[model samples]
Target: MANTAVRVRLTRGASEGDVAALKAWLERERKLEALRSSGELEIQERAGTQDGQGQARPMGAGLDIMLVLIGAAAPKLFDEVYEQVKSGVRAWRENRRDVENGEPPEVEVAPDGDGR
Candidate 1:
């Protein structure tokens, strides 16, 4: 009978579309998981539908925040965010590999021709 919301602002390294889509996906995953864990998601919504339509779903499906790129930032804003996330994930994996190999955990990412 209740709902919740989570607002997140990536202070750096996130584009408008990335933030929007990520926020929406995260919110739904969190909500649905919470509802299922709490035993709140009923499965009868499609039972009475005449042609596959069903009861209303919970929460709106879109970003609530404005996603305006920083006008003063460099023109390759989208690429920057993509590379940053990719590099971060790579570094995290490298660190884990280092740890598993009985070595010190180290994090570093080299650019693949795109500025990072």
Candidate 2:
């Protein structure tokens, strides 16, 4: 089975707290747990930003999240989970009065080392 990596770039208006809550939700997500048990999912999180001087700053309003999956069925699994998560994120953002209307987070799938 091949391994695939999926990267999710959060929307610009998402606060650090939003990212934290999303991370926590993913941790306790039942679907993710099932994927973990089946040996098909691995998750990594990247929060904060780089300063103009190239310094790593503290957590901020935007973050990136990565997920690695293994198995022949990984692509399909990623799609399913991504849709569910994206929907949840949209709902979460809608409830927040601080965020402005704009493009939502984007998910990119990397297959064979080329991100598309």
Report the number of the highest-TM-score candidate: 2
Segments of candidate 2 deviating more than 4 angstroms: 1-3, 47-62, 94-116
In candidate 1, what are the lDDT values of residues 78-98, reduced to their tens digit?
A: 344334434444444454445
In terms of lDDT, model 2 sits at 0.56
The global C-alpha lDDT for each of the candidates, from Candidate 1 onward, is: 0.31, 0.56
Cα lDDT tens digits for candidate 2, 11-81: 54556655666666555667776886788877667652653334774455646556667767876776676
lDDT measured at residue 99 in model 2 versus the true structure, 0 to 100: 65
What root-mean-square deviation over C-alphas does model 2 reach?
6.2
Q: What are the TM-scores, per candidate, against the unseen true structure?
A: 0.23, 0.55
lDDT of 1: 0.31
Give stretches of model 1 more than 4 Å off: 1-76, 101-116
